[model samples]
Target: MKKRYLVSALLLFSVLSLFIGVTDLTPLDLFSLTEDQAHILWVSRVPRLVSILIAGASISICGLIMQQLTRNKFVSPTTAGTMDSARLGVLVSLMIFTSASPLQKMSIAFLFALLGTFIFMKILDRIKFKDVIFVPLVGLMFGNIISSIATFFAYKNDLIQNMSSWMQGDFSMIMSGRYELMYISIPIMILAYVFANKFTIAGMGEDFSKSLGLNYKTVVNIGLVIVAFVTSSVVLTVGMIPFLGLIIPNIVSIYQGDHLKKNLPHTALLGALFVLFCDIIGRIVIFPYELSISLTVGVIGSGIFVYLLLRSKLGSKSNAS
Candidate 1:
């Protein structure tokens, strides 16, 4: 997809997003905004829009780097246990920190997310049977184990209700002050762009990158750090937006090919557009009522995930034939 078209679509959807909530602000209101309307626009609508775009773009790019480094299409924070571990980290904060500030909680989550992702990478290295789908299937199981532990901890601590809030991805609660932590993803994403070529080189396998004078472990660790930071920030800020990372990168790779640097922007734009579309649908599907983002994205993203799996399988069969 062309950059211009993506930007145009993003701008259009962003405008529409500002107008879609419970309030009745419109483009015409730009000319004559009362104090109440302006307050709502800045404190609610604008922040929501900004956070949506940033969260979408950051998580999708994180997925791209993960897939590149692991050389697996099905691996992402969602699939690879990173998010679950981050959630567990939040639970740990509640149990230990008790009166932890948001920043403190996020710090704990970031560490757990990083540790979980590292373990997943270690599993990838140890297992020689990394089938196209098998790696992420393992990751899914690993995530389930972490989620179960988090759930158990929540039950023991009587924090199940609090933990459940972060389990569901929702933008309905995101306001100006609550979402600034996600800004951390901006610099991490820029670093991802800067390391794009090294990631590409690393994905070719350790020996190949080493032959080129690259320290494969260092580059891979950097990529994982970036992934962990972005994952933790988005989960902490927006809860869990399932499958935004997995499906967007695959869709972009089909038409755009696998050039990491080139595909980064398209992946980011497509992610924002998709999240905006889902948010709009969630808001309008039942009028004043709403579907959580987790539900909407899960349904649509899983459909696409299945399609990608089948398509890959069929392509393999045809090639064999």
Candidate 2:
């Protein structure tokens, strides 16, 4: 019932996002668009909308898979150092392949992200932390360390401003040529859906999964690879939009339960809708001037995160009592 409501809300927001932009486009303008207006709608607005939907859905689904595999609700690309590592990979690409094409940069970034995520998984294996909260805190610290290193390099190479610009997560620049890299996430998301059952079983702990004859390590590696690839593609194409992954999956799981197969579609839908809603609010809140998707999602997602934290705390207290 709640899922239905959320889906409906998401659809409404997506439509609004399509029409509401810096340009003077409304429901009335769609029918009689000037060439310029038509160009803007087709080249800019449509691409931005598509990027937002693909990026949001991909990241949130990645987070859901990570959480299930790790058996921790708080584990996500942002929270688990995956995004930071990918960002570092982007920096490396810029430095090493200064003359490389965008496609080349993306390939290098994807490789680096894959390596970094693998390292994070190894770290998870070595850690003794049994509590869920402690796990994410560890990830936070790990991400910060990587981010710090990336910032240092950006500053030294006189790319700090460029890196900062990329980090802001804006949809305003989503014209046709610039935003196509985001389409890469669509196939990756489908791959995730295909392997949904393996991920769920793997999340049940290595011993249990192995007892059932599932290849736990292989399944986990596949999940991590998908996460790294999706995260890198989105980061390269759209910059970093924080907390969409963490918040969207958590919200979906509340209503749909944790079955990965069942919740995957809901997660993807809610994520797309959530980003579209945020993009629409961003477009209209200041009229011609707009907030970046990162800013809007950050403020809103923080509130939701706080609420989840409180709910978890309360649930724990009740259990103790």
Tens digit per residue, CA lDDT, model 1, 1-321: 788999999999899999887778889998999999999999999898989899889989989999999999889889999999889898899999999998899999999999999999999899989898999999999999999999998999899999998899999988989999988889889899999999999999999999999999999999999988888888888899899889999999999999999999999999999998898899999988889889999999999999999998998899999
| TM-score, prediction 1 | 0.98
Candidate 2 clashes: the total is 0
TM-score per model over all chains: 0.98, 0.96
Give the TM-score (vs. native) of candidate 2.
Answer: 0.96
Candidate 2 per-residue C-alpha lDDT over 205-250 given as tens digits, one digit per residue, 9 for 90 to 100: 9999999999999999999999999988888888888888898889
lDDT of each: 0.92, 0.86
Candidate 2 ranges beyond 4 A from true positions: 2-7
Among residues 3 or more apart in sequence or in different chains, the pairs in candidate 1 whose N, CA or C atoms overlap within 3 Å are none
Stretches off by above 4 angstroms in model 1 are none
Q: Which residue pairs clash within candidate 2?
A: none
